[model samples]
Target: MKDLEGKTVFITGGGGGIGGGIAQAFAERGTRIVLADIDQGFAQEEASRLPRSVEVMTLPLDVRSPESWKAARVEAEARFGAVDVLCNNAGISTGFRPLFDIPPEEFERVMAINVTGVYNGIQTFGPLMAARREGHIVNTSSMNGLTPFASFAAYSASKFAVLALSDALRDELAPQGVGVSTLFPGLTRSRMSQADLGKISAGDPARRAVIEANMMEPVWLGRAVVRAVEHDEPYIITHPDYREGLRARHERILAAFGDPAQPDYHTGMTATR
Candidate 1:
């Protein structure tokens, strides 16, 4: 995990914005790249752009499908020894809509790709990494995963699930020497937002405004991910502004607890006074 040179990275959504950036970064480091995406053409195009010296393969993949994962794993291992890293970077957003107003299918699709898709990646690639006793897994959660966002209930819920999943997996994999890291990227300039949400008309102007405001360059996120892997960081957060929000949320949780040593809150307060 420390030295990426000549290692192989199996990346989901490699044709997409953040995924492409991640692939490019690793490829630049002389890492072998296995790029998977739902769009075959796009994946192939990205793979072709990588340096000739780097071993590259592109496969059309649907993260929602377990069969797709199995096939890709087989092909990757055959092409490059064992995968050194698995980047679960593929995701989609349901755009800005009140929970009640959102279609049921929209919620299901988002959960399938954003939440279950990540679970599939971990489940599929985890065993391979375990066998090697040396590997890294990076799951992409969003800034919304750390804090609730208005009109993005489904997307937020899925990301929150990813955050919890990554944490649990990290604990489970630690003893095995496999590294698990979760990425919380802020608004990045990616096709994920535009492609996923562009179809739905935003009923509220304020909601649309908030979405537009959070967009950042995907390359910034890519660089952060590379650094995280180098440092063996468990949690990679892209937005600095969200730190205050995370702190506030933590404070709220701490506030909810009473002194466990005290049988009665009134008595405890009276003694302190």
Candidate 2:
């Protein structure tokens, strides 16, 4: 995994801010890239930003569809052989709406893209990586996944699922010589984040400017992802500002653990129950 030069990397959502950043970072390492996005134009835009010497391609990919994944994989492998790194980074958000206020369809859409999309990518490409016994996977979650926030319940739930998926996949792939890493990003400047800000601020210039000022550059997050892949790290946390909040949440959960509902319930005695 440490060796990336000449390696082929396939990224979902490659047209978005974070995905584009990740592509640029991989380009810096001499890694060939396949930029797949639902919007082919965006993918091409990001691909254009990479140096001419870097081999990069853009393809329209609907992460929600297995057939799309199959086609993308076929094209990517046909162009550059087996993907050395698979990034399940395509996702959508609920725009900071309250849990109850979100429509059922919107909630479903978030889960479809944020959670199922990652699953589809893994199902499509993971087996190939296993057969090769040499590859890495990076799944993008969010800080909200670690510490759920109000007004972003559905988004948080999807991200939490990503974290769980990445952790389980990491363990499952370890024996097969494939690695998995979960990226928990915080307020990175992206079209999605910008749109969210516009919604909340009602396009208020001052508010939008303040939010923009605090946003992290996507390239920094991209570099972190590269490092994680190189070291086979399990978690790539690009933002530590939420550490205390996460610690408090975990401490509260630990405090909640207590006696079982039935005092006489023993570890092995409940098997038949």
- For all predictions, the C-alpha RMSD in Å is 5.1, 2.8
- Candidate 2: tens digits of C-alpha lDDT, residues 39-134: 999999998889999999999999999999999999998999889999999998788788999989999999999999999999999999999899
Task: Point out where model 1 deviates above 4 Å.
Answer: 196-214, 259-273
Please give the range of 10 consecutive residues that has the lowest summed lDDT in model 1: 264-273
Which runs in model 2 stand beyond 4 Å of their true positions?
268-273
Collision pairs in model 1: none
What tens digits encode model 1's per-residue C-alpha lDDT throughout 174-273?
A: 8888988899987676787765445553566676666767777666787788888877899988889889998999899989877656565453344220
Number of clashing pairs per prediction, in order: 0, 0
Question: What clash pairs does model 2 have?
Answer: none
Error of 1 at 52 (Å): 3.5
Best by lDDT: 2
